[model samples]
Target: MQIRLQKIIADSGLCSRRKAEELIESGKVKLNGKVVTRLGTKAEETDKIEVNGVLVTQPSKKITIALFKPEGYITSKSDPHHSQTIMDLLPKELSYLKPAGRLDKDSEGLLILSSDGELIQRLTHPSAGHTKTYMVRVKGFPKPQNLAPLSSGKLKLDGYLLNPMEFHILSVKDGKTWIRLRLTEGRNRQIRKVLDSLGYPVIYLKRTEIGKLQLGNMKKGEYKELSEKDISLCFKT
Candidate 1:
């Protein structure tokens, strides 16, 4: 059977389909020792597939990982500015894996990385509404009325109206407020923007859970491979 080149690379645990497309576009992928930059190309099992001169073989098994990302690391492979990236947090053996979603360089918490692109696609899809929970510390405690917009399902930002999200107050200490929130969409800097718009101004933020996976006891910069059950959970949720 013939499969798309992107699917082949993704199943090989070398990268996600999106990243595979990028590699193809950038002329890093080759077929049968010849560079093939065309998207949607197909390959049979007997055909040779290589990326950057390395053969891409289908994974005999699939694996996913959860990493406790600390602040100050980019979630990318290479940055021209020489900033540290998430790929730096993993061992050399895990370099081919791609992140399922992103946590901005300045925000940190439970982040999922995987070789299974299908699972990554499903988990990262905005329509799935998979819960991504965060612990946010804001600089000042605001009156409850200011938070009504979030609970009311009508907060608009940048001309976009946001759906109601979980915005529970966990505690308020001194002059700051610690809150637990759950969001379905992965808007760019959404949590920070929403809180700042409310005049709270995020002082600290860390994601604790996504779907059934939790940051757990993993310390900063540490990661653990998911069990078979946990991998299944990614699809279920």
Candidate 2:
């Protein structure tokens, strides 16, 4: 069956479809020994494909894992400026897996990494509507009224309007506030910015759940390969 070249690259788990398209446009993708830079080029699965000089083929076994990412570790495969990355916490054999979504270095907890590009697309796509649950601590105690902007879902920061989210106070202690939030959007530094706008800067943040998948008993820096059932949990509302 003929399919778009970028789709083949994505299905092979080398990267996302959007990234694959960029690779193709940049003349980094070759089909059957010929460099093809056209965006809509089609090819059969049997056609040889090379991405950046490496052969692209679907893995015999798709792999996914749930990692309890710790603070201070970058969520990428590598970074020249950073000394630590989430990949350092995994075995070399699992290096092929890419993080489906991001958890900034300052934040910690459940993160999903997968060798299945389709799964990655499903988990990270904004339209998926997957909710991420976080436990947050902020400076100063916040009364219910202070959080009206968040509950109203009208909070805007960095020129982007945030989606509706579930927010509630867990406790107030030692001049700090602890809260739980469930968000459907994954804007960068969103929680921190939102709280900061309300005069409650975040002191700590940890994501404990993605959709129905929970961090459970996993300790920081630990990870477990996900089973089919466990993967299904990630899509559950």
Candidate 3:
């Protein structure tokens, strides 16, 4: 069977179809010892395909793992700060897995780990508009007017304006407050910065859901392989 070169690259988990097309246009992709920049070029299973001089072959079964990351673990592959990484908690066989989206070192909860680069790109892309739900415990209760800025898109942090986000109050205690926030964008310490600017600093934050997948009862420091249904739902409309 033959398939478009971009599809082959995407199916191999090298990158998304759009990114594969960009790579093709950049003349980084080769077929049969020749640089092939034609977007519509097709390749068979036996065809010798290479990207950036590395042999490209169809990837094996895609693996998706849902991990409950604990606090104090970095979400990177290697950190010069000498901090422990999320990979340190995984089994030896999962060393190749990369985090789909990042959770700050002080925050914890559901982190999707996968070896499928295309799936990672799809899930993390802002255009995909996948909603990430977070349970935030703040230092103080904020007035309704304080949350107005979040929806108004006027909340600017570090010279970058934040996107409109949905905020829902979950509970309130003596001085502490619990809130559920949903956002389609992932910026560095975005939720925390927003709350801090509103005079209600975030004390603890944990991601509870992504798209239709919920963290459910997964314990801290534990992980589970995603089912076929989970994979389908991730990219489903």
Candidate 4:
């Protein structure tokens, strides 16, 4: 019944599997009183496992949460620079949940956090093809012809070709243009970079949806625990 060390740590709600690997490589994880640093090392459930001197145990209940992340809060559990993190918005009893995906500090919107390692993997993995929707406000207004190339999957940034996306104008007000985009791929700062390249320079950006899970009317910095049915909505292509 031996399981991978990272999986053991992740299932114990200590951290994501990726972060568990980092902890193992940094010699912060030990198996049966001996440091085990190899990525694929395995041990049985009966064996004692420790992470940063902490004994690991599986939680009796698994929890998933949908958080309305506000701008300026880092999406990580901890940062070396001591910046405020999303964890600060949660109660101490729910500290074991890890963010499934990230929203940069400058952007605000729907963010999912979960204690289920498999759910985190499915949501973050590229193969999942989950659609994320964003509401963006940018400077100036551009013609439809100018944005037609974006939906054709011909947009390139940093020498990388992006996937086809759905982009359309939602409104225009006071010298600013509001638009919505649905993207199947999540690239680093892709929306901001794309609009900037198109000469529209984003003024504001917020993600409103992931798959069929909508942000609803949740206020910034508020979070709600998800029921099993609600969690399934995230995978409803």
Estimated TM-score for each candidate: 0.80, 0.86, 0.84, 0.82
Assess candidate 2 and give its TM-score to the true structure.
0.86
TM-score ranking from best candidate downward: 2, 3, 4, 1
Candidate 4 structure quality by residue, lDDT tens digits, 45-111: 6888999899997554678999999999999999999988999999999888889889899999999
- Kindly report which residue pairs in candidate 1 clash with one another: none
lDDT score for residue 213 of model 3: 86
Of 2 and 4, the candidate ranking higher by lDDT: 2
Better of 1 and 2 by lDDT: 2
Candidate 1 weakest ten by summed lDDT: 228-237
The C-alpha local distance difference test score for the whole of candidate 1 amounts to 0.84
Q: What are the per-model numbers of colliding residue pairs? A: 0, 0, 0, 0
Predictions in order: lDDT = 0.84, 0.90, 0.86, 0.88
**For residues 140-211, what per-residue lDDT tens digits would candidate 3 score against the true structure?**
877677788988877787998778899998889979999999887889999998888788999999998887
User: Which is the better candidate, 2 or 3, if ranked by TM-score?
Assistant: 2
Superposed model 3: Cα runs more than 4 Å off: 1-4, 11-14, 31-34, 40-50, 54-58, 232-237
Better of 1 and 2 by TM-score: 2
Candidate 2 residue 69 Cα shift, in angstroms, is 0.3
Clashing pairs in 2: none
Q: Whole-model lDDT, candidate 4?
A: 0.88
From the highest lDDT down, the ranking of the candidates is 2, 4, 3, 1
